[model samples]
Target: MRVLAAMSGGVDSAVAAARAVEAGHDVVGVHLALSRAGGTLRAGSRGCCTIEDALDARRAADRLGIPFYVWDFSERFREDVIADFVAEYQAGRTPNPCMRCNEKIKFAALLERALELGFDAVCTGHYALLVDGPDGRELHRASDAAKDQSYVLGVLTAEQLAHTYFPLGDTPSKALVRAEAAERGLTVAQKPDSHDICFIPDGDTRGWLADKVGAERGQILDRAGDVIGTHEGAHAFTVGQRRGLSIGTPAADGKPRFVLEVRPVSNTVVVGPKEALATAEISGIRATWTGAPPAAEEFDCHVQIRAHSDPVSARAQWRSGGVTVVPDAPFDGVAPGQTAVLYLGTRVLGQFTVDATVSAVAVDA
Candidate 1:
């Protein structure tokens, strides 16, 4: 089998590419230049697609004795991930750029180009499993539950899964992958894993949004529709956010306040008690299935709203092109523009971007 190993210049990806070569497949290592920020080097494991990262990926490929190349996809990334991120926030919604990258750039664009170039599969270092199910290949959690990345990959379509390959899915831990890289004489063995969003170098999301969309001072409304405080821009806020809101005044109940809603139309930031973030229902859009869409119109399933949050029990109602999930109990922080991945046991049934939420507690605008 001819495979294109998508090396991310990290220990996990180096070991994954080595494993792919060890499996007797014809493999080629390819580093994606997604950032293309004047070829600057990444510092402290914060930036992705930096010149240093590309060099590290090349070094790993040389150690593995495979052909290596860098594929530039910065324009696509800016349009699909970065631009979409700013747009979503400007519209008073929270967007997950990592999920967007997987959906648009990695799995979709790269996979398509790989197929066109006569590659049988596009391999990555993602910690997620592909198991044969009753219907076809089904995605599952990795052996290392803590490092499972199946959530971000929830936006993958059935066609994308047909050619997707995760070589590190069954690895017990990331440490072991680094150890394997050491054994294979790869240089990325001790490279620190990136934790922050790639584009936000300093990790100041509010500041970045502020720079993008200039400050527009607006009223911060209480639950009773009365102005409590003022904020620079509503685009800098997301539903359920607690910190960074300089509300100036505390809630009458003396409890910590949370952002209940961000109204872009009214240019208002609504703040109330943290309990106001609790939601009972979530409506999702742009649903994509890993394999086949469920034939049943409605069913009980596990819904994962956040990447690291535990999957909550939910009753899902399948709509024409999307699904509405009602949690068995109240769920907090059901933010819009986030992916809601659905699962039936360990198998990923599908996922959709959250567009609307119905909180258990009523919130005022």
Candidate 2:
């Protein structure tokens, strides 16, 4: 089989490409240049598309004796990932740029290009697996659940899955991959993982957005409409955030207040007790299913509101271009624009963007 490995100049992708070669398949390395000049610093150290990263990928390709090339997808990336991220925030919605990248860039654009270039499939270092199931190709959690990235990849369409390969799905821990790189005499053996978003290298997403859209000073109010402080921009804050609120007043109970909501139009940030953030039900927009939409009215599943959050028991119902999730237990600070990924056991069923939440009924009512 011929495979086009998506090398990101990291030990994981390098090892994934090497593993493909050892499996007796023809392989080529391709790195994506997703950033333009004056790109924002990455969120964590785990960034991609840096000049150093491209050079590392080239070196790995040379060591593997496979043909390699750099594909400039910066324009498409800006359109699909970075621009969408800023737009989502400006619209009072939290967007996951990585998920968008997988859907629009990696699985769609890159996969299409690889097929046009006569490659059988495209490979990546994602810690997820593809298995042949009764229905068809199925995506499963990786062996190392701690590192499983299926949540971000849950948005892939069925057709996209048909042409994708996750070579590191069954590989050992990330530590093992680094060790293997050292054993093979690769320079990036000890390179720190890229933890930050590729476009925002410094991890200052709010500052970046403020610079792009222009800051709007707004009033910080309590639930009772009392002005407590002032904010530079409403888009700079998110639900559950506690720092940089600049609210001088202490709570009636003398506890620190947290951000409860962001009103973009009025440019107001609502502050309240932490308990005020709890909600029973959440609604989402732009829900995408791996296969066809679910046939049942309500299904038992586990829902994850954030990338690092543990799955919680919930009931899901499909609505118009969206889904509503009611957690069996109250979830705190369910923010708008964040993704709610659904899972049936270890298989990722689908995901959607949070739109709103339902308050629990009062005891008297």
Candidate 3:
């Protein structure tokens, strides 16, 4: 089988590419150039696709004795991931760009391009499994729970899963992946993981957004609608954010308040007690199923609200062009725009982009 190994100039992808070569597949390494600016360097090890990174990927390809090319996916990435990110926040939703990248760029555009080039699959270093199940290809959690990336990859459709390859899914740990790179004579074995967004290497999301969209002065309001303080911008605050509220109106209990809502219309930020963030039900938009969409309208399953969040037992129902999730108990911080990945045991049933959440108060009402 011919495979396009996405070498991200990191330990994981370097090892994954090596593993593909060891598997006797005709593999070629390609590092994606995601950023538009060529001169700007990545701040520390927090960014991806920088010139240094491309060099690192090239070195890995040389060590493996495989041909490598730097593919420019910058325009597509900007339009799909970065632009959509700003728009989502502007609309008062906390969007996950990584999820968007996986959904739109990697699995969709990259996979399509790979197939056009006659590659059987596009391989990545994502910590998730692709199981050749009794029915067909199925996505599952990685063997190493600590590095499981199934949550973000929930957006993958059945077709994408069929052409996707995660070679590091069965690895015991990230430590072992680095070790494998060392044994394979790869130099990225000691490189740090890129923790920040590829575009914003410093991780200053607020500063980045402020530069794109002017930071509008907004009112910070309490539940009663009384203005307790002021904020830099509604886009700067996300649901469940605790710090930077700067509310001068001290809470009666002296406890810190959390962000409850970001009203884009009136440019207001709502703050309340943490208890207000406890939600009982979450509903999602644009649902995509991996195996089969559930037969029953409502069924028992586990729904993960965030990428790093724990999967909570919930009751899911297909309705109103979305999937409504009713947790077995109250769960906190079910924010809009986060993908709700559905799971049954180890198999990923499907995923939904969280559009709305019913708070515990709303549930009781």
Q: How far is candidate 3 from the true structure (C-alpha RMSD, Å)?
A: 1.5
Model 1 regions more than 4 Å off = 363-365
Q: Which stretches of candidate 2 lie over 4 Å from their true place?
A: 38-46, 360-365
TM-score for candidate 1, please give it.
0.97
Question: Against the unseen true structure, what C-alpha lDDT does each candidate score?
Answer: 0.88, 0.85, 0.89
Residue-wise C-alpha lDDT for candidate 3, range 247-304, written one tens digit per residue:
8779878888999888988999988888889998888798999987778999999988
Worst 10 residues of 2 by lDDT: 38-47
Model 2, 1-365: lDDT tens digits are 99999998888889889889989999999999887673443334656788878888999999999999999999999898888898888887767888899889999899999999999999998999888877778888888878889988988877888888898898658788788888887788888788767777777888888899889889999888889899999999998899999877777789888888888878888888777778799997888887666789689999988877889999898867678888999887888888888988888888888889765633222
TM-score of each: 0.97, 0.95, 0.97
Top candidate by lDDT: 3
Per-prediction backbone clash count: 0, 17, 0
Candidate 3 residues lying further than 4 Å off, grouped into runs, are 362-365
* Model 3: lowest-lDDT 10 consecutive positions: 356-365
Q: lDDT tens string, model 1, 20-130?
A: 999999999999988767366667868677788889999999999999999999999999999999999888889999999999999989999999999999999999999
Q: Report clash pairs, candidate 3.
A: none
Better of 2 and 3 by TM-score: 3
